[model samples]
Target: MAEDRILVTGADGFIGSHLTETLVRQGAKVRAFCLYNSFGTRGHLDRLDPEVQAKIEFFTGDIRDSGSARAAVQGCDTVLHLAALIAIPYSYAAPESYVDTNVKGTLNLLSAAKELGVKKFVHTSTSEVYGTAQYVPIDEKHPLNAQSPYAATKVGADQMAIAFQRSFGLAVAVIRPFNTFGPRQSARAVLPTIITQIASGKNEIRLGNLKATRDFCYVKDTVAGFIAVMRSEQAVGEVTNIGSDFEVSIGDAADIIAELMGRKISIRVDEERLRPDASEVERLWAATDKAKALTDWRPQYAGREGFQRGLTETIAWFKDPRNLAGYDPSRYQV
Candidate 1:
């Protein structure tokens, strides 16, 4: 059998860039679909090693454009759709953009993949769909509650992937990862927000809800889960959760980060940083049994060990002036 030819949308973003690098290292021919920008920027893809960058075929386009989406999918055996508006606070301010990018963009990819007879379509989803987690350890069968416009759009996109699988017999699999964090993550995310602030040598760390719990997965492990899902024949038309299955409250996580950095910092709750009462997701804990059963995927990094390892790497990156230049630790990132 020949190596799979893959198209990774949002290949310039945090998780997408890492996934793209891994796919290239694994000997898969990768076509990276980065958003078209006036400056010809490739987001975090520019941070990748020169050799890894050399191996990828960069395709600059927008997912919302049907022509771009179709062109990106053409002649690719597999399509991993990761493009979207992911920031919750930004989603609250601009819901129409989320619907356009997450919903409509996904529709375009599905249509193109189906039309071109792509062998596998891996749709990226988020644990945010299970808002607040009605029950502990959210399973694949758990109900989806869109607490924010971002989550709502993802829910719509995920259902559309399923619709294509059933309605058009398209080979599609959905991977819902919970709070993936590591290097190249934007400050909008809690982990990066905290890490950047700490690395800036701030005496007080400004943050929002400390009580909100999350199941954090290291980016590398999350990327491995995506590959496992792609390789598993049993994962087609299925939704799998990629997570560490370990929950950590925002407050506790901040403390851990401080310890890992060997810095003593005070946590100050910033009113401006808090989400709307109703929109805030109080808790999220993923159940990975289905993913393990279907894809034989188990997280290599779990619990405190994983959290420390991931945070250490993230802190080291942020401490460097070069990597730190892109972020503003003083401002509250939306």
Candidate 2:
């Protein structure tokens, strides 16, 4: 058979960049879509090894514009949509922006995919859509309660994608990943936030609510899940969760990373960092049985291993004078 032509939107970000690299390694002709910036920055994709960078076709554009989205999707067999404003704290400050970028942007992509007759559209989702996890292991059918503006927009985006698949036969699949963490992750994410601070020689780590528990998956494993979903016919028009079944509280996670680093640090809760009580998803744990059955995808990295790997890689990156220059650990990132 012919090799798949793949377009990965948000290829500039953490997981997207890794996914783009993986596709290229697997012999896919990849067009990497990164958000346009005045600096002509490619984000993490720019940091990828030169060999991988050479294999990718780069396009700078905004997902909010249908013309741009359609242009990017054209001539591609599969479209992996991962672009969005993902910071929960920032979403609270500018909700309309999230709705525009996440919801409307998704609408534009789905419409373009439908028009372009793409073979498959993998829609990325987050476990936050199932707020607080009323059930132990959140299944696909779990009720979606958007606790934060970010989660609300993602919920809107996922529903819109599925609607197009069912109503217009767009061949869309929703892949919900829970807390993917790794080297390229933004410091705004909890894992990177804590690791960066401690690695910066800080004796005290400032954080938000530490009681909330989360199910984290390594970035590579999460990317693998995406590939599995794309290859599986059974995943079409279906929602599959990519996550480690294990759960850990923020406090415990911080301690684990600190212990791994051989550092004894005091963790202080920053008021500005805490989410509103009602808006906070107290707990999130995912059920991957459907994914295992449909895509035969299972998380290869457990909590401790995943956490250590992410912490080790992230710490090494942040320790680099160049990478550290990009991050301000003392400042509370949105």
Candidate 3:
């Protein structure tokens, strides 16, 4: 894949940043599509090593803009669409914004790719789209129930991406990953919220519902799945899950993290941190059989291994005074 042209939208975000770096390492000529901002921030892309930054072409624009999305997709062999508002709590506050960005934005990308003749489009999706899981191991055939606005918009966006593939013969595959976590994950996520707080010398971790369970995958593994999907012919026009089959409740995950960090912390249920009853995705576990059968991809890291790696890297980042500036430990992010 060396020297192949690729574009990764949401390149400045948690998963997007990791995927962007992975592509660059594989010798792809990468163009990172970052969201535009007046502050001129690149998000996690700015945190990349200086050598990696030099190799990338950065395009700042909204995915909702068809013209800009078209311009970015032109001449690219693969398009990895990852840009969207991802916070479930925030989605409740502004659903219209989510629709415009996630749904309409995907529409723009699909239209652009259809027009430009992009060979493969790897659309990023979240496991939250499955809601609280009607089955233990959720498969692509599993019914979707959007419990939150965030998941609802993703469902809409994902459907549109698939529609283009079926209607126009666009080579598109949806890569739906379960909870992906690592160093650059935002504070809004449960893992980061706990890690950042504990790393900052707090003896108590304030969290929302701890009974809810999730299937967590390290960012590296999730990014690798993206590459595997992009290269596999069977993956084209398919919706495949990239995740570990196992799951852990939020409370257990917190306990595990605390143990890894050697911190004896008490968990406090924060009212402001809780998701609305209707919006909460109480359980999310994935079945990766399709991905395994199609692309020969499997998760290498289990819960303990993934958690340890995440903790070590996250602790290192949070321990740095400069790196901790953006995160506000004093206030609840949600």
Top lDDT prediction, candidate number: 1
> Candidate 3: how large is its RMSD?
1.3
lDDT of each: 0.93, 0.90, 0.89
Candidate 2 has its poorest 10 consecutive residues by lDDT at: 302-311
Off by over 4 Å in 2: none
lDDT of 1 by residue, 1-334 (tens): 1377899999999999999999888888999999999999999899888999999999999999999999999989999989999999999899999999999999999999999999999999999999988898999999999999999999999999999999999999999999999989999999989888888888799999999999999999999999999998899999999999699999999999998888899999999889899999999998999999998789988887877887788888888899888999999888
lDDT of 3 by residue, 1-334 (tens): 7757899999999899999998898789999999999999998999999999999999999988988889888888889999999988888899999999999999998999898888999998899989998888889999899998899999999999999999999999999999988877889998888888887889988999999999988777788899999999999989999887678899998998888788899999999988889888888888999999999687876556765675577677766888777788768886
For residues 249-306, could you state the per-residue lDDT of candidate 2 as single tens digits? 9999999888878899999999999988899999998899999999868787865676
Candidate 2, after superposition: displacement of residue 137 in Å?
A: 1.5
Better of 1 and 2 by lDDT: 1
Model 3 lDDT, full chain set:
0.89
For model 3, the stretches where C-alpha displacement exceeds 4 angstroms are: 303-305
**What lDDT score goes with residue 284 in model 3?**
89
TM-score of each: 0.98, 0.97, 0.97
lDDT of prediction 1 = 0.93
The runs of at least 3 residues in candidate 1 whose Cα sits more than 4 Å from the true structure, single-residue gaps closed, are none
How far is each candidate from the true structure, as Cα RMSD in Å? 1.0, 1.4, 1.3
